[model samples]
Target: MTPTDLPVLTIDGDRVDDLESFTREFSTFLDDHTWRGNLDAFNDILRGGFGTPEGGFVLRWVNSDRSRQTLGWDATIRWYEENLKVCHPDNRADVRARLDRARKHEGTTLFDWLVDIIRIHGPGGRESEDRVHLDLR
Candidate 1:
């Protein structure tokens, strides 16, 4: 299936505090599938949840910086690994390239990359709501 065919799951990062809550909320948000205590199941859910697996899906985490800190670096890495495993083989290379870009650029931190994964995989493109903007008052 084409990238545009993939579903988009937009997460409000402000609400995710820990893995448990994140998982709970995520599952609730999808409202069709449940985690089966395995990365593979998690992967399946990531691909489409109750939706079609062939098309996969995009997970956009808003306020990613805060979410990254909340999830921690190790968790983030684990997430990346799991995400890669679930990605279609044909798309893996492109995903890896995105990861590399995030690693190489000082401005595009790991947190940024985590969020970008969603945009790269789907037709949502980029939106202001996807990012966390800080305003000094």
Candidate 2:
């Protein structure tokens, strides 16, 4: 099938400052029109059947540069902090180390995490069978 035939979901990056904001926007892709999932949940959504067509969809991100900066190191640290609070005790140390890395500007930013998730569902990715495509405009 041609690219135009598949479903497409677009989120304006300029409007998202952090993971919460991104989730709020990403909820537009869910069947219930609301978000209650974490990063893993976001990945599941990409697998389709959750409002997204099982056949797959195109994810369009506009003004992504601004988003990359906004969700950079500081956002990464915040993400880890939130997880640290409710994470399983055994995982706390790992989360703490990640947070420390973010503080040192040494690990993935929220934007990177998001793009990685999306790409995983794209061409040549592990789930490339889904036919999900990334449109970073």
Candidate 3:
């Protein structure tokens, strides 16, 4: 299935009032042209939980500028390992596990991480466009 075809998991938040707005913006951000090309790869990363589950989120780009020029999952994984260093400082174990799974191309570690984050932070929790390191904690 395609990235667009994948379902978006709902997450809870501190203020239920912000949920609607967050969902709208989050959907827009993911739907942006720059993101569409690599939506699958981003989904792959999201499925792995490189981003935080609460407060903010992240997207891995093959290029530093985050332009969706590449068309491969390996590039997404490489982007995470080479450039993006997400995960809370205390969550190093989680990060390392994700790294290892990504390296081995395992699905559980990656998708569970993604589901957990989305469940914890909801959509608005994703990182801001200008943020380099998304710290949800």
lDDT, candidate 2, 27-93, per-residue tens? 8777865666488888888887778777888888899888898889888888889899999999999
Candidate 1 residue-wise lDDT, 1-137, digit = tens: 22344455566778877555666656764555665434345544444436433344445566766777776654545555666889899989976775555455323433444344434334444432322222111
Model 2 residue runs over 4 Å out of place are: none
Which of candidates 1 and 3 reaches a greater lDDT? 1
lDDT of 2: 0.85
Candidate 3 — which pairs collide? 47-110, 47-111, 48-110, 53-117, 53-121, 55-125, 56-125, 57-126, 57-127
After the best TM-score superposition of candidate 1, give how far the Cα of residue 135 lies from its true spot, in angstroms.
22
Q: List the residue pairs that clash in candidate 2.
A: none
Local accuracy of candidate 3 as per-residue lDDT tens digits, 53-72: 33233432112122111212
Global lDDT of each candidate: 0.51, 0.85, 0.37
For every candidate, C-alpha RMSD to the true structure in Å: 10.1, 1.9, 15.2
Which scores better on lDDT, 2 or 3? 2
RMSD of 1: 10.1
Worst 10 residues of 3 by lDDT: 62-71
Off by over 4 Å in 1: 1-6, 29-31, 52-54, 73-137
